[model samples]
Target chain A: MEFPKHLKYSREHEWVKVEGNVAQVGITDYAQSELGDVVYVELPEVGTDVEANNTFGVVESVKAVSDLFAPVTGSIAEVNPQLEEEPELVNSDPYEDGWMIKIEMNDPSELNDLLDVDEYKTFVEEESK
Target chain B: MAEPGDALRRTSLYETHVAAGAKMVPFAGFEMPVQYTGVIEEHHAVRQAAGLFDVSHMGEFEARGPGAAAFLRRLVTNDVSRLEVGRVMYCTMCREDGGIIDDLTVYRLADERYMAVVNASNIGKDWAWMAARKGAGVEFRDVSSETGLLALQGPRAEAVLAGLLPGGGDLGAIPYYGAQERTWQGKRVLVSRTGYTGEDGFELYCGAPDAPALWEALMARGGGEGLKPCGLGARDTLRTEMKFALYGNDIDEATNPLEAGLGWVVKFQAGEFIGREALLGIKERGLSRKLVGFEMVDRGIPRHGAPILAGGRNAGVVTSGTMSPTLGKAIGIGYVPLTHAAEGCEIAVEIRDKARAARVVETPFYRREKA
Candidate 1:
């Protein structure tokens, strides 16, 4: 699992990369590995308001379906349209091309409540145990 | 995750599975591998080449005596009397009310000896049902714990398995649904040309202690041929693509064989069986709900328990579903009203609160060419 220090992580196994008022959201590497082979990704519509820690979408693998929670409160500015055709990108490159949605942050301060790389790593370790 | 304190049972190949980096999960009381490498990779391996699977968790029972054939004939919906020695017949065991007890395969080992392989989850229940129906001259034995089964499936299955037999017996002599005794590592084993996946495959049955060795030997010999070790996940997807009815998902005690589109297995000419009267009545009354195969005409994937809609009204529910790796389309089996079960009928599957458009289609969605 690669946890980049520059990004913020959520306990739900999602990572957030914030720049100015816009933030990019995607599942962490740990999440994709746990999900095995992702076959479909159901994304929220663009411009949909999502609250922090609330479910905004669903990620379906071959065996199970999992909820994708929002890391911070915002409206979805854009959804990666490429996921519609190739959901495996979420498994291949979860942090880059697999980025799910872009959100225009409603409260940028909400990012502080999210875990840093070190904190997220500790959380993952504890959960696995 | 397999916790040490959990009461999950382990199969004979548990250590082998662990050594191979399998992800173990509790399934039907056994800690079984849900995946080894990945579902898609393992699935394609079975389709294009061959895949090995440890299906030891499934239950097996033997009936032997002078009246074994007679005793067994009254249990299943299929005509077991028609089953010749060295052949197998797929059938459903049902309660008197026409509710299915379990879908099983009956293998005629001899004129006076037979075996019934049942779903692991229904082992205890099915055993009790059979035992209660036991007669004076037949004997019953639960051989599930002592026996292990492995499925070697796909296009290249014969080539791979033929390498394991010492004298290199002509495996082609075993026709589909045929079973014969063979020697493996000096131990007599039963090899059946039957599988849930619609592929050219053989199911090998042996003593529990011989399972790991058999698995290891086959893997070592077939590794170069791309014979990957598959798990229940791939087994499920492959069977779903073939439209094979799973016991719990597709045909449970509440769902009769007729309603599940297994009427072919119900032979009225075979005389009285457990569910004969009820099934005959059902046939006379016609079907209200029928299980039909459908493909998503829209974007979303249909999942188990998803409500099916006909003309925007609640119709039925999805029983087994998956995004088929081979077909590359979202496909599912569900019980819809007879009116909506017709092929090419437009329907909607409620997926994650959204009604996705779909259409009823012909079953056995994926079939391999006869070699």
Candidate 2:
């Protein structure tokens, strides 16, 4: 429910924090809560090329499995190694320690296609209703 | 996934489940709660303390008449004649080819009457199957829509039930698989010391109209003792930990009782049942494949339909798998070639496109020590 003003979100509920040419990606708090008790996180290997709106990995909960979609096109620079041993981090701290991958943006202009904080909040509210 | 407009059926406790913030999902054509607080929390509560579940979606059928017992004996694999009044026996109904129709529990309410509780999804199918085989002198009644069932399970079940239905003649005296008729808040209810979870528990069967009131009473009375309201998610994990065979998952029409490791319930000596001849032949010919329990020696959890491999050859497929809440590790049940089904045998489970090392182990992965 908490959509931070500084982050951009995708329709699939992933959030991206933009910096100078580099961006950090993780699923939003809403996404983590919807998928309960995450048991395993499968991430793409580092140095892999990931395109915007494509699946980069899988997130598995006890009851279901969901795809982790990339919000923006990029070349993966770093993958979250901590998730391999403790996937519950995604449930506990989805924004900070649970950041899945860091991407060197292919074209920062793609950020304009993503939803801002207010728009993402409205999207979540309407989708849930 | 069920369509959004599929018109899922609701149980009598539907409102109560919603009010408690349960996550409802479409299961077996019913809108049932998959979890209340959380699956793991509810699972641990039942293992360490107690939990209550609304199992009203299950079906109940009544067979009554002078020939009721005999009619039932012809359909199911178990010996229904051995069940005394106020006792229950786990049984399986199979086709003529030895394929299981459904696994159920037959309750002997009286000398000339019996009730069979079956899976919710198999109610219509099982009803038609039994009705087509009905003989003279017996009346069949489909009482499923009018009945309500609740399972209060865990180690502390007896103490909690004693508080609600006081002076019920020492409920502890009711042995496992035993049933007794008792009055609860003015309604006659059937109380049975039985459960799907491998624990000391009791199931309460009553009229549909009293379901809401009974659930409320159980929660209010047992809440102090940490009896959490559980859902189907925990029910699944608990049963999987015990390696209990689930109907559609572990055993289906394509699988027979002899190969599914349910031979103990098929009493061949008890005489002429629907699948007796085929099962007898199967027993004589030796099993081709066997259901075996396995635990992951690697990381990743195995899921339903995952292929089991022995030396890179397709051995079988996983029927049921879960991250056991009690054992804190991944475990599963699957069928494999008879030659590869022994304990400590090595096999790999295909998980996420990679074969993960797993070892065939003895069931039940978890067991509560008798106190």
Candidate 3:
């Protein structure tokens, strides 16, 4: 599973790429791989307020439906509309085109609590073992 | 997420699944393959070409003796006498209260021999139920462990099978829901022109020892046509698109066939049966709830057990749902008040905290190519 060195990941398998006050969030490659062939994505509506670690959306794969938790507290700025048509992007390019939502980080400091790429990799490997 | 010593049972082809990079999951007490290659790809392959499925986890029971037909006729809802030798019929086993015991396919091998293929999880329960109703001269044998079953399904399934077996070109004329004894790789096999997926396909039943070889042989022959080893994930989605009733999810002991929309299979005129009286009364009293299909209008998926609502009141729960690989839309099957069972009835399904708008639609979200 690819965990980009620049991004931050949550225990729930969501990843965040923060740029100043705006942050782009999506599920990790590890998450998409485990979920398998995502069929539907429920993204938080734009301008919706979301709390860190709280469920803001859901991802439905062929096998099961899973909650997509917010990695950091923020007001949703934009949600990926493309996911409504092609949820498999979460499986194909989870970190880039599959980005679920943009959020105006309410407490950017919360990003520190998220795992870095190296730490996230170790965490996933240990979990798998 | 391996659980140590979970004791999940293994099918004869369990090792083969693992070798194919299958994602194994605990299902009905067996370590079964949930996916191989992927769900969507396998699902598409089954729609366009042939896909092989290792369905050995399904249970098979043999009922033989002079009274076999009479015994099964009373046990299941279908009119077993209607089946000729070498034919199969789908039926539902109902409790005395008219609730579903399990959905099964009955295969008549001869005048005095029959085979009932049941869901794996309901084997013990169904066995006990059949034993209690067993009368003199009928013998029931639990052959689930010794038998291996595989499904070869798709538009080109017959072509693929004919390419592998000598004189197999006639398999295309077997007719849907027909079964016959055949020889494959020196083993006597039972090839049935029946399947759970809504596709023209054949189900092969053979000894457990021959399952791996058969699967490998078919896969090798079908490789040129984009045939993939499908797992239960694709199988579930494929069957769901056809609105096929699954045992635990769609019909359970707590729900009767009448409410599950299987009343047509219950032959009340065929004389007395185990649940005949209750089911006949249900037919007279009218159904209060009925299983219906629905499509999500708003964003979100309606998962199994998700509450279904009509005018903000609880109407039912989703029994099965998926983004149909064929339809490219979220579709599900659920039970609702009989008043709301008509096609085009607007409804909503609660997914998480949001209620997604949906409309009751006609069943069989997908259709197979005509034979």
Candidate 4:
């Protein structure tokens, strides 16, 4: 439920840390806790083109498999390689070491559509209730 | 939506499970614990050492009267007449077409007294089936709600149970598939030297009120050896390691016992019984498809209902699969063409629109150390 003030979040619980045209993407802490004990993470290859609000990868837990949707339109610049051996990083450090991809933003204006920390916190609280 | 009457159906250890921070889920019409601590941790504990399981949700029925043996022989697939006064035998309740109703264990307590321990989900259906077919001199009674069952299983289970009881004698004399009545804490309890996990263990049955005391006693005595309270999650994984057939997943009314690799339990030579004719006919002919075990060679885990492929063609579907805690690899069971059921036969499972390489391996995937 910790929504850092520096990052922007999507309705699907993904977070993006913006820096110029380059942005780092990963699921939020709330997403990892809800999923519980991530066993496998399927990440898209670097340089792959991703559309906003489209599924780009998969995350599997012991109970079920879930689709990871792209929060913004971008071209993947880098993929986290450490997840191949340790998927639990998504649960332990979702915002830092567990970042899924680094993307070159196709349209920086799309950032306006994402929610801020306070708004994202309210969204999750209302959804849970 | 939750119903008001749901609270009425609770196991004897319901309060204890909730107190231990267990995740409660509705299973077989009762509130049951699905996990405690976590599924993976509890599963590994049972595989390496001892684990206690509250199986009180399982149904127990009694068949008593002068003709109890004859009556059970007609209902179940195994030969009940061969069981002695204090022994147990595994059997299957088959339909008229040789399809399985449920797999159960029959314990012959006396000349005219017998106990049938069945799956929790099949309690109502099985009870009605037996009651409708009550023949002359046979009587049936449902004693499920009053019985409390606990299973203490793994490599060090015998030592823990023996230490809890008085005299602390060696239980090594109890052979596999054996049962005897014993006293624990001045209370009469039936202890069975059997378990779903392929381990040296005992399953204890006592009155509902005595279950809490027995569980506490065993936990206290087994504290040092990594003995933990396991939930349904661990129980499922433990059974799958031994290639044990679960009723709803592996066999059902649509699948016959012959096709499910349970033909050995059907005693066709013994006199007439329900589903006997169909099973005999199946034996004379041959099965078109048979259940086989497979291990994934790729990274993906195969799951139930996933399509199986052989030689790049759709061959069958997986009935059960999991990332085996003991094997440290993905394993599954599926029904494939009879010709392709041999050991080491290559196959593939379609997981998430991708075909993962797999190989048909010999079961069981795991075996416990002999005592």
Candidate 5:
């Protein structure tokens, strides 16, 4: 339930760590925990453009399928290479090695609409209850 | 999911599940555990070691009196007349038009008595179907509320079960599809050799009040044996790997055994049974659609309600699907036109509105090596 202070989050449970023009994206630890044992992650290829709040990929657990929503609109610069063979990393290291994509931000100001760590924590608490 | 005012039923193991930190969800009108540690972990536990499941929500009914065997056979598609005492048979009870009512297992509990284990969701409807068809020489009893069931399934199921029996002799005496009357702490218990998972296992039926103790004793004995308390989530993946037809998903009121690849259970030779004529007619006319197992050739995972695509057009629909924990790949069951149901037949599943390459393959998706 720890939301890293440096990362920005969305109500859909995605996290973004923006450095300059590129934003690194992945599902939060809380998201991975709720959808247990992620067996497959279908991600958009590099260079593909994605829009804010739209589905960019699908994360499948053993019993359920979930959409991975884009927290910020951008073009995909790079995708995680390890996830194709080791999707379990999403559950094992959701914040680091499980980072899904790096987005070249189309509208950096969209970051204003996303939640900060504290706001995301409050959202998770209320949604779970 | 239920309405705000609706109350879901709880099994006798409810407290134990909660105490073990299980994730609970609504299933068949009961607040049942969907997972404990995790679905994939439990699935592997069942495949490699052992897993215990609280199947108490399933219903049990007993029919007694003279000619009960004959009466029972007439209600289902299988010939129960040949079932010896302590033996069990799997079959489906179908409507007059060959539509499936529910698939169940019948146990010959005594010379003039037979018991049926049915899906929990269909308890009331199944009971009414049976009662309406009861003839003069048979008396029926619903023991569902008074009974509790637990399924211990896996490769090590025998060892785990034998440890709990003390000096009860070799469990090998109970062959597959066999049931023996026994006791747990001096209460009547019926142990049957059967399971939905593709593994050697046992299903124990006991008095509802005895369930808590029975489960605790099992946990105590099996904890060291790598026994994980499994839930409906793992249960689905396990059964899906075996290609077992779940009542609500794979087969339902609108589906027939002949078209669902369950024709082997529809025996017409032994005697007259319900749906015999309709099934016979279906067989003679040939099935227009057939249930087939398919695995994705590409990345996407197919799921229930996903359209089955053949020749770039909608041909059928997926009934059940999952990324198998054991095989580590996406697999699903779907009904496709007979023209596209052959092994190696090319088909596609529409995943997220896109056609994903797939092919029909032989089922079951996974089978345990014979001991």
Candidate 6:
């Protein structure tokens, strides 16, 4: 379970890495581990507008189907092309190559409401119990 | 995630499963492991090497009497009278109206002694149905609670079972769907060359108390050879890949044999059975809808209850479906109108309100080559 100190995480088990007005989004390490061996990933188009806390995509493991929620209000800037051919990257390297999308934020201040490295770790611990 | 709750029954190997880091889930009224390691990994192990499955939650009923063969013949859709000693027969026990009660396998231990293994969840219902139709000369006993079953499946299953035998006994004598009794570790055990997975495998029926030790022994002997302890998740995917009909999902009380692609099991000439007459009627009237295997032409995963569409109208429903771990493609089994049930027919499965392109295909999507 690796959580980079600079990224923000959502209660829905997604992580956000913000740079300027763009934010890269991917599921957290805890999230990918819980969902064993991802078989398929469904994401929105690059220009699609996604609201915060709303479902923007679906990730299907062999035994379950999980919804991916947007951590902040944004429009899709980019989507990972590698995931189409290699969905298992979500299980192997969830933080880096497995990133789902990049969003151009509508309200960058929304990042304040998200959890930091320490806060997200604590939140995950409570959720697991 | 829903908790299994304290009321769910536990199998004898419960402690061992927890120790092995299995993800436990509620299944068939028991706290059963849904997976260990992962479903795909465990699935490939079963197809490539060997996999051990603790199917002790399945039910077993013993019938012994002067009329045991005749009684069982009348109880199921298959011809039980032709089941010689040491052989096994697969069939469905249906009601008089031809609704399936349960699908089970009958093992003929002797000329007048047999065992019917049923689905774990249907034990009570199946038992009552049989007992109500019990005759004066037939005696039925529910031995489900006292029996533990383990399926050793894959290419290396033969070597694994032969290693555990008392004195290096070869399994060549036990043909497919054949059973042999042996005193294993001083306990009476029946080793049957039968399995639901599309692999050459064997099932071991032993005392319930002996499950944990037996599981440990097989794991220790076969683990080094790539035999992993699999769970219900792997069991499901393996059977689904073979297109084996599940009792609740594919064939239920409302589904009959002829339309479910099990007409061969319903042998009217094999003598009297509960649903023989109704099945004959169904055959005469012709099938309106039939079960067919399909492959997704699009990227969506078709699931059970997904509405099937064909010729721009509602056709039928998906009975069983999944992303095939071996085929690397999404495969599903569902009922479609007879006009759209052919091997090359074009159909669409509506997944999450959007129709996805799919085409009917031949069944048993993945068959293991004889090794």
Which consecutive 10 residues in model 4 chain B have the weakest lDDT in total?
B1-10
By DockQ, is 4 or 5 better? 5
Better of 2 and 5 by DockQ: 5
Please give each candidate's TM-score: 0.98, 0.97, 0.96, 0.92, 0.97, 0.97
Output per-candidate TM-scores for chain A, rounded to 2 decimals. 0.98, 0.97, 0.97, 0.97, 0.98, 0.98
Let me know the DockQ for model 1: 0.89
Off by over 4 Å in 3: B1-6
Q: Give the residue spans of candidate 1 off by over 4 A.
A: B1-6
Task: Please report the candidate that would top TM-score against the real structure.
Answer: 1
Model 3 lDDT per residue over B161-271, tens place: 888887874785577899988887689889899998999999999999899999999989999977899999999999999999998899898899888988888898887
In candidate 3, list every pair of residues with a backbone clash.
none
| Residue-wise C-alpha lDDT for candidate 4, range B1-371, written one tens digit per residue | 23456654788888888998887778777888877776677877877789999999899999999989999999999999999987899999998998899999999988899999999989988998888888889888999988999999988888788888777634665667778888886898888898898887889999988888888888889999889998887788788878899878888888888888888788888887899999888888989889989999987877789999988999998988887877777799999998789999999999889999999999999977664
Model 1 over residues A1-129: C-alpha lDDT tens digits? 798989999999999999899989999999999999999999989989999999999999998999999999989999999999999999999999999999999999999999999999999999988
- Per DockQ, the best of the predicted structures is 1
Q: For all the models shown, what interface RMSD does each have? A: 0.7, 1.0, 0.8, 1.7, 1.0, 0.8
Evaluated at residue A3, the lDDT of candidate 3 is 77
Candidate 6: what lDDT?
0.91
What's the C-alpha lDDT at position B208 in model 1?
91
TM-score of chain B of 1: 0.98
List fnat, each candidate: 0.86, 0.43, 0.93, 0.00, 0.79, 0.50
lDDT of 2 by residue, B300-371 (tens): 788889999998888899999987878878899999999889999999999878999999999999989898
lDDT of 1 by residue, B157-226 (tens): 8889999997675788899999999998799889999998999999999999999999999999999888
The model with the greater TM-score, 3 or 4, is 3
Tens-digit per-residue lDDT, B213-262, candidate 6: 88998998897788999998889899999999998899998899888998
DockQ for every model, please.
0.89, 0.66, 0.86, 0.39, 0.79, 0.74
Better of 3 and 5 by TM-score: 5
RMSD of each: 1.8, 1.7, 2.1, 2.7, 1.6, 1.8
Residue B167 local lDDT, model 3 = 82
lDDT by residue (A7-119, candidate 2, tens digit) is 99999999999889988999999999898888788888888999999999999887787988998888999999999888889988999998999999999999999999999
